[model samples]
Target: MTLDTKKNAFIELGKFLSQFSEKDTIKKKDIVENDLGPLNPTLSQVFFEEFQNLIHLSQSHNGWYTPEQVYFSVQSWSEALTEDNLNQWVGAYDLSAVQPKNIALILAGNIPLVGFHDFLSVLIAGHNVLVKTSSNDQHLLPFLSKCIIAIEPKFANKITFVEGKLENFDAVIATGSNNSARYFDYYFKDKPSIIRKNRNSIAVLNGQETTEQLAALGEDIFRYFGLGCRNVSKIFVPKGYSFVPFFEAIFKYQDVIHYEKYANNYDYNKAVFLMSNFKLLDNGFLTLKEDASYGSPISSVFYEFYENLPDLQTRLQSEGEQIQCIVSNNLVENSIPFGQTQQPKLGDYADNVDTIRFLITIK
Candidate 1:
């Protein structure tokens, strides 16, 4: 199919998704009556109702996929899949004469619809996609794929979900932990590939942040239950920095402790820390531990003392591969602001790797 056809299909998909959110699930009149041309009104209603059910049912399939988090993911994508955003993201590339190739994707289920970017990239680059959905996030993407097909039937030929081994693919894009990345690298060594490994985000605090910014940081830490790679898993604080203001600001999110899954993680991780005789600063809901590691366990955030910004920059540069995003209040260059790490734009490719460029340049 043509690029315009694919773009229009996704734009329609975005409109469909915009109808559902945590605040409300109002069906828009334009979508039901005007926008979906080839798709009959009855079929549109079926998709609308089924998607609402799937958003709630996703929690049963994976406890981390709470309706609130799922709705946030849906809303983020819906806002992103606009005509202007799509044009700005893809307009930089020349895809008119590209040869279509089969691109295989092995997705990670740590967050809701985490692999949608790769799926969208492959298709928008005029290539066929073979997807292997992570068991933890099996339903959402496929359901949306059906919506895309309904809008533009041409996509039906370009998308495939594999149950067994992936074959006949020219390239691969796989996201997993560090150990699984090793396997992907070796197995796909002969093919053009992008193998993503585990990486965590960190926040830098100079002890001068406002209560509002600190509270916003809570969203960066707690959204998606801290499972996403972009979540702030650690923090950097100046020496003598106290946790009083930070703790007070994030108190609004204490409701997270009521969730059984998160509460279990909090209890288990805290017990292990205490049994190991490690000192911890605890709120009723979250824990803060002083450690050198970037990857912290769920319900806890690892922190370290920074002597100065220059030295911290040097250290972060040296350990860049292990970090995904640096959350700060304009203290560091190119650092994402508080509460915005999870709201990456279409161009904010994971690992800073250019996915669309990789797809179109494949021979």
Candidate 2:
């Protein structure tokens, strides 16, 4: 596809999502129903158009990719087939380059539709996919594939969803936690693969961040109610940081505190914090605790302070491989950061993975 055609497809997709804006966004009941329903409405007219955008637009990135980047992915898809970037599209190869007969994807279940990109890539790249979706998020995918078949029915057979392994598949791309990474490495050692293990995303907040910056940070921290690995579960703040200003700026999400699962996590963590005598600044919903670890909280997360950039850099260096990207004012020459450690732009993935392009190279 020409770049313009690809871009136009995404614009059309975004336009389809505009309908959601007309509905009652602030209604708690509406939010719940939408998140549980039309949120994944594969056959709905709204979703049909957006799915095309999602497939063509492509949104997986450093963290949860912004909507804009998804659009660009489609526009850039065909470019990967050319020679200049072919080496990258095919990945590093030795001996005779080859294509796999099948590809297996063990998707992570933390966020809404986490494995969708891998599925799209595998299908578009011309390989059969053996998908074992995380049970926690099992509802939306097959519906999505079904919708695609309704659009471009020819693709219906290329993507398959199942609960077990396909021994015939020649390769694998798995997403799992750190512990599972070790298992995947040992289990799939002989097959060529890209196994995504656990990585904690971080936010580096300089003292100069604005109120708007803090508010946006809330989006990064709680988009999936802090369930996603990309959610900024931990943050690095400058010394003498004030939690009040930050909480005040982010208090807009207090309604999320009422979410049953989110509330349960907050209550559980708050009790633990009280017993352990950890300092907390609760605005009735979220809390900020220093010296905390990743995956430690729900409505609330963790943060630590640094004396200077050098000290923070030293600490970050030790955790580099385990980290996806450091969102800060200055992340080295080529490093990227969105407005005050919030959203990541297109192409800021861990290990710099261009996943959609990688999928197309299966052949």
Candidate 3:
């Protein structure tokens, strides 16, 4: 299939996804266009209904995949998969003379549809993809693949989901923890690959942040229950920084404690911290611990006191590999704005590795 054909297919898939969100699922009557023309109405309705069922069924398949979280993910992708966004993202690459290769994708299931960007990247670059879905997030992407195939049957030849061991792929893109990344490194050593290890996002605070910015920062923390690499797992504060304003700003998210899994984590992590005599600041739902680590457990955020901005910037730059995003009021260079980490654009490549540039260059 041509690049335009693949782009239009994904655009249609995005339109189909646009119908569902946390608030409601409403099907539009606009006929989806592919290279061949408009999709059949009956076929469109079938895919729409199937997606609705998948949204509810996702929670049963994985407790962490609550409908609201799933909907948030769906809505984010829907907003991203537009014509302008696609053109802007891919326009930089010269894909005209590319030779199609079989690209393997080993996805992480930390959040809903976490690996969809890699999937989209492979196809948009005119390559076939062999996907191994993480057991924690098995259903959503395959169903979306079906929608893409329905929109453009040629995609059927370009996409494959391996149920057993992965084989017959020229290169690989895998996301996993630090331990698993070691295994991927050893196994895929001979092949050209991108092996991603665990990373965490953090925020830097000078103690002058507004309630609005802090509250928005709460979205960065609590969204997806803090499972995504983009989630702000830690924050940097000045030596005498106060937690009162931060706590008050994030209090609106207290409802998260109502979820049994998160509450269990809160109770368990809090007990562990107390047993070790670690001082913690608690607000009934979330906890703040003065730990130097970047990766924090669920329901808690690690914080460290910084001596100065220059030193902190140098420190963070030195530890860049372990960090995904730095959320600040532009205090640090190239830091993402508060609350925008989770809403990454199409070009926001994970690990700052250019996936498209990697894909098109593969021999």
Candidate 4:
């Protein structure tokens, strides 16, 4: 298929997604000039109905995949799949010379639509994708794949959902925990692959940040209940930094404590830490504990004090592999703006590896 054909197919998919929301969904309208041409009203109704069903089923299957979070994921993708964004993102690489290959994807289930980027990348690169969805997140992407096939029937041949051992694929892109990453590295050693492991995002807080900015940072920390790698699991502050303002800012998310899974983690982790005599700063709903670790348990954020900015930057660079993205008000180099870590653009590949470039070169 031509690049434009693939691009248009995704654009139609975006429109289909745009019709869904947690708040108010739009009424169906006929879209002209799309690859589907005249917007099959019958299929649109079926798609939207299925989308609604999947949203409900998702929360039942994985309690963490709440309807709000699932809708947020859908909205992010709808915004991302615009014609301008898609063209600008893909224009950077010359994909014309890329030969279609069978690319296998092992998806992560921590958050909604976590693996859609790889799924989209493989197809847009003109390759057949063999997707092994995490059982925790099996419904949404397959529903989306159905929408894509409805948009461009030929895409049915380009996308496949696998259940057993992954085979007959030339390359692989797998997302898993640090432990599973070891297995992926060994299993896919001879094949071209990108094996992603656990990486946590951190935030650097300057004493000068506004209350509004700090409140916005709460979204970065609490979105998806802090399960995503892009969620800020830890924060770095200057010496003697006060927790009052930070706690006050994030108080809006106190409702997260109502979730049984998160509340259980909070209560359990708190007891474990207190029993071990670890100093912790608690604000009823969330806990801030001083530690050197980047990975923090649910409902708690690890924090560290930095004496010198340069030294802290050096430390981050040395532990780069353990870090995903940084959120700050430009306090640290290459830090993402507070509250924006989850809204990654197409070019922001996980692990900072260029996935399109990898797909282009996969022989």
Q: Could you say which candidate leads in lDDT?
A: 1
Ranking by TM-score: 1, 3, 4, 2
In order of listing, the candidates' clash counts read: 0, 2, 0, 0
Model 3, 262-337: lDDT tens digits are 9999999999999999999999999999998999999999999999999999999999999999999989999988
Residue 291's lDDT in candidate 1: 100
TM-score of each: 0.98, 0.72, 0.97, 0.97
Candidate 1 residue-wise lDDT, 2-106, digit = tens: 889899989988888899999988988877322445646566567678899999999999999999999999999999999999999999999987899999999
lDDT per residue (tens digit) for residues 61-126 in model 4: 999998999999999998999999999999998998888899999999999999999999999988
Residue ranges of candidate 2 with Cα displaced over 4 Å:
1-100, 331-346, 354-363
Worst 10 residues of 3 by lDDT: 31-40
Runs in model 3 with CA error above 4 Å?
A: 31-44
Q: What lDDT does model 3 reach?
A: 0.92
In model 1, where do residues sit more than 4 Å from their true spots? 32-41
Error of 1 at 154 (Å): 0.6
- The lDDT for every candidate, in the order shown, is 0.93, 0.60, 0.92, 0.90
lDDT of 4: 0.90
